[model samples]
Target: MTKSHDVSVQDFNDEDSNVSSNPTFESVLNARLSRRNILRGSIGSMATAVLGTSVLSACGGGNDEPAPGPVPQFTPIEKLSFAAVAKSLEDKVTVPVGYTASVIYALGDPLRAATADYKNDGTDADFENRAGDHHDGMEWFGLGADGKASLTSVDRGLLAMNHEATTDEKLSSFFLHADGGKSTLPRPAAEVDKEVNIHGISVVEVKKAADGKWSYTKDSAFNFRLTPWSDVELSGPLRGHALAKTKYSPTAVKTRGTINNCGTGKSPWGSFLTGEENWVGYFARGAADDAARGDKSVVALKRYSSVQGGASRHGWETAGTEDKYQRFNNSKTGASADGSDDYRNELNTFGYIVEIDAYDKTKAAKKRSALGRFAHESAVFGKAEAGKPLAVYMGDDSRGEYIYKFVSEAVWDAADASPASRIAAGDKYLDKGKLYVAKFNADGKGQWIELAMSNTAIAAYAAYKFADQADICVNTRLAADAVGATKMDRPEWCSVNPKNGEVYYALTNNSARRVDATGSQVTVDSANPRAYSDVHKAKSSPQLGNSHGHILRLKEDAAGAAATGFSWDVYLFGAEADASTSNINLSNLTGDQDFSSPDGLAFSPSTGICWIQTDDGAYTDVTNCMMLAGLPGAVGDGAKKTLSYTKADGSKLDVDTYVGKAPAADTLKRFLVGSIACEITGLAETPDGKALFVNIQHPGETTAMANIANPSKYTSQWPSNAGYGAGKRPRSATIVITKNDGGRIGS
Candidate 1:
């Protein structure tokens, strides 16, 4: 659920709890001053859990296309062509000299031929047939001219994007209502309907015109939505699970919808895997609900940070007593111990990786529960070998949560890459996998600990006794905790470097990080090594903790993704260009490459370029959330470095860790700076790399609900400001970026 301590969804983003303890160690960083011209100097923590040592060396994966898409050959670019874009605070997107960004799809953009256009005032309805709000993680599935999935089409494809959530600060999501909505309890049914429909995922067909411009079809045959009310199945280990039973489906065979979908995954056999995040904030549980459920149930419920009393996110449950509304109230009201008679177990139905075949509308969406659920960000498959078990890398986007890898029981089969039935292929590889939580050590090594009932730690966990495989899957966080998995920063988006099999993930900044332990916050660890005050907050005092997050990369043991051990290093430490060289600016970032809160990361298969996007607040006064293009080296190219930090007690503490090799001007640089109050996320590229699709989420998000009547007081009116829609109210949209000469982007 949203933050319980009266914080806005903007800062919290559904990272349920806070963590506060600083680690003890030594580190020295090499910080740089310029973004476009620095070959910064070397830098780099913790004695983690005892684990076997494993060696990792970089191996460029053979150009592979797992999904049924055009397999464009990748030639790693040794240098970038465009000059770095300058930082800006403008209300419009800024890009380099030769690139053009065009808006193709946006909030309320009609997907059905009969749907009405979005008026952009607060009165729009029929969101089910319109583009949903807050576009986040997205994937591209090629469409051949024959109107089927293709491996050759670049100009035509289906863009499946996650809507994530609606923007709200006060108790209600004001942007969707006619009068900024009711702030108190007991929301209206009409308002709740619109809010609920906009928090899922949308798949629309987009194509390029002869003029080289991209736009979405109003009624593409492949267009559809997996809304909160859509029928879905809980598949894999959680199929027919007792905890999944609800009034809607006593047998636990089905559920209503997917909500708060964040990161997305592209299935090798052609499907869209969307992660359900922050769904906890949508349901409200009565204060007495916890007592009724008793101690054991409360432990799992509270661990998920679901509020026990009063308000639910936007007061969605207070609309009416209909099953549609009542399901939002996760209170124990029925007598069935299996939870078959009430919606008390409704919360357990979410927090999963739901897979849908965008190309095949005949199949229903299925939540693949075998992938241990948490605040899942994005799931990226490692380089797939024809005979090896596929490994899917994932990160729980909440603070101090664990990173995970799911190794399928089935070996890769090239014939299944374009399977006769994508859904059945999902059943083969995704439904049967061993989930492992990552534990990174101070010795620059990491191990994957299995989270199964058979594991001694999980079997004898003193906290909560897991009953079965389904129990372990449902209460994955507890299983991870019992196994002492390394707690991390806010791990968000992750991608496997197509140039090298190494995996890199963004540890989005955590407000809960602290030099001293308290609550959910913890001290600096080797994997999450930075803890300092952010000096960029102009109106308030500097914020403490890892205000500017870092990017961490790990290499799977030599046997590839199926291996249990790995080596790791800090790829890049996000910071302001002006931050200290020895500590905060560990990566020596220059103005051109400097960024904060790396929330979205992806690697281009056509160019082997790393795309980094930010969801930041600490450095917003200086710049809006932006995207950068990077050419990353292997995991351990840089030398070891020691870092020193000052604790609250006025004493210095030292921590040592490995740092990735420094980047030259051409290796990493800012590519685009977004509109006012926006998060630059959801990246996808054509196989040829000629078109880069980016999702600009919630631009002008700071507009006060009170300012609904005063358009001038609105923080942003983008897409509209940039000339796309009707009103001045900003709308989240997908923008396509292309080079002027129609060449591969980042070439």
Candidate 2:
């Protein structure tokens, strides 16, 4: 029911943006699973231990057969002690029995003291001074009582999070409008203005009270929101380049606002890095404009458009005649043949790693253009030492997209971690970097393809002629294509193992995969080797591609993150415990650990636990979206395994890919489950690792607009039903969880 143009990028995708001729990471497309019943069993008794010869025989052990022992877990991981949280379909958050989840911040919460309390009804306004909606990726920045940056201040700290779009259906954000808003075009200016306020990023100070209860400080000096109207400078390679200029910033030094902020990260120098995901859907492309632009521009534009149409995601452009709102319209396609006077270039300003100084709101946010951009999921810098070069890894959050790594031109200086100006430190390390995209080989090895103008392939490309390095940075997707990067399956959040320096990435499920020759359907390949059907078991939510995604990890050949050669493997394959085949359930997941669409991933800096969050549909019938805590293993713990499948014409195909050591209950277990229609997104933790912060996004998101009046019919009435917020209408919230006895989480 979701047309690509009618909803956000997460719901549907009608555009095949991957135009590369490289091998598509193919899998059989989709379905989801969920159930409320509990399946209690031991680690060995659970059906997850049945790893046939096709999966585990690759390690080349001394023995001829597998070890005669209980289901083996990753030996390097610490033994988990908490009982796995049972899957639940109830309209509330569920955690381990000993943990308490308290609502710390929620949608419409007052960020400033003067802002009135949120009525929880749709009439609320002034979101600029209040907490924005759909809280996604978040990071913890500790601050002292006096508001200076702190490394050990648990009582006072800043929670910098992204307000990733809104909970909307079709074109209208009904949840924010009193009369369920307008579902048609020429949307009311007032409605558009509210939406414009609810997006971008927010930095609020959260504190633990004397009574041990956690809450946000209403008037903290650290609190601020970067809305669509805020000023943001374009830095690095595109600082004053012509390709980055628009009518609003003709000189191209700056632009207005950031949107569609998704996953987030903490820079080495104590700054916040946020990825601009799926920002193209927000711009309106006029019909006539496609023909007016240069041929190369059209090629790049179409590849960037996930859902191409004249209609904007929200009708912000039609709301007014002012340039502020009209800027949302790429009508340059209709006016200037070359877009010299239009806002076409405005689109180029976005999709970069925007760095915000966590400690200083006075510093304007900068778009780090040196990091090649596409649908940036998030950018995580690897372990930084005193004199080594720093490498930041990113994933393009789209089907058949590429994973990227940017190595800084300057060597790391430990003193920069606490430099006088964190933003200046960002300028030193992030502004000049060598951007490279991953190319995974079938032989279980990968190379980083440099995305520079000096590269022969990019310099001599015929598809989209590269004018210079500045143009290449702006059109990063096309540049990645020209260099033939390995197309992955919706690569999402990335995390680095503090214990081993290995990097892990989430390849959230893809829906465009196929096993045979189908129009626009991807074929099965090594890195993305599964293309099975989920319809047989998950009857309610039939889908295409890898519905239950898997985790892929890489280890540098050398000890440093700057190494260009790496060894990689599929770490854990998400699946139902009852999965009939061993190929799909290679991780040996049980009911307590199985999940679909691994989207949000982070490793606790103090605990070394990989927290896996899900944004799923296929498995909703069985349980709500959830989070899993896992202990990671180093790369090469397991060896190559070949999976065989029969195509529609009865021809056999074999896919050889690297698999990691299978996870048992002791290594990976479900930790928390969210409410109805809610996605378990952003996560953060105290330095002590005793307090965990999680973002519950878009609860009751499927509530039909027709039933907006009837709270009983809404898919969910969360935080409200949990007695935390004011109204019965559900609100996205950040919940703080801690052990009842005050112990570390996921221990």
The numbered model that scores best in lDDT is: 1
Q: How good is model 1 by TM-score? A: 0.92
lDDT of 1 by residue, 477-591 (tens): 8888887777788789899998889999999877765656555666676777777666553656667778788999999998897899999999999987867777678888888
**What lDDT, from 0 to 1, does candidate 1 have?**
0.81
TM-score of model number 2: 0.91
> Cα deviation of 365 in candidate 2 (Å)?
0.4
Best by TM-score: 1
Deviating ranges (above 4 Å) for candidate 1: 1-70, 646-652
Residue 282 shift from truth in candidate 2, angstroms: 0.5
Q: Give all candidate RMSDs, comma-separated.
A: 8.5, 9.7
Error of 1 at 56 (Å): 49
User: What is the Å distance of residue 118 in model 1 from its true position?
Assistant: 1.6
What is the per-residue lDDT of model 2 for residues 432-458, given as tens digits with 9 covering 90 to 100? 878989988777778888998899999
* Regions of candidate 2 where Cα sits further than 4 Å from its true position: 1-15, 25-77, 306-309, 333-340, 536-541
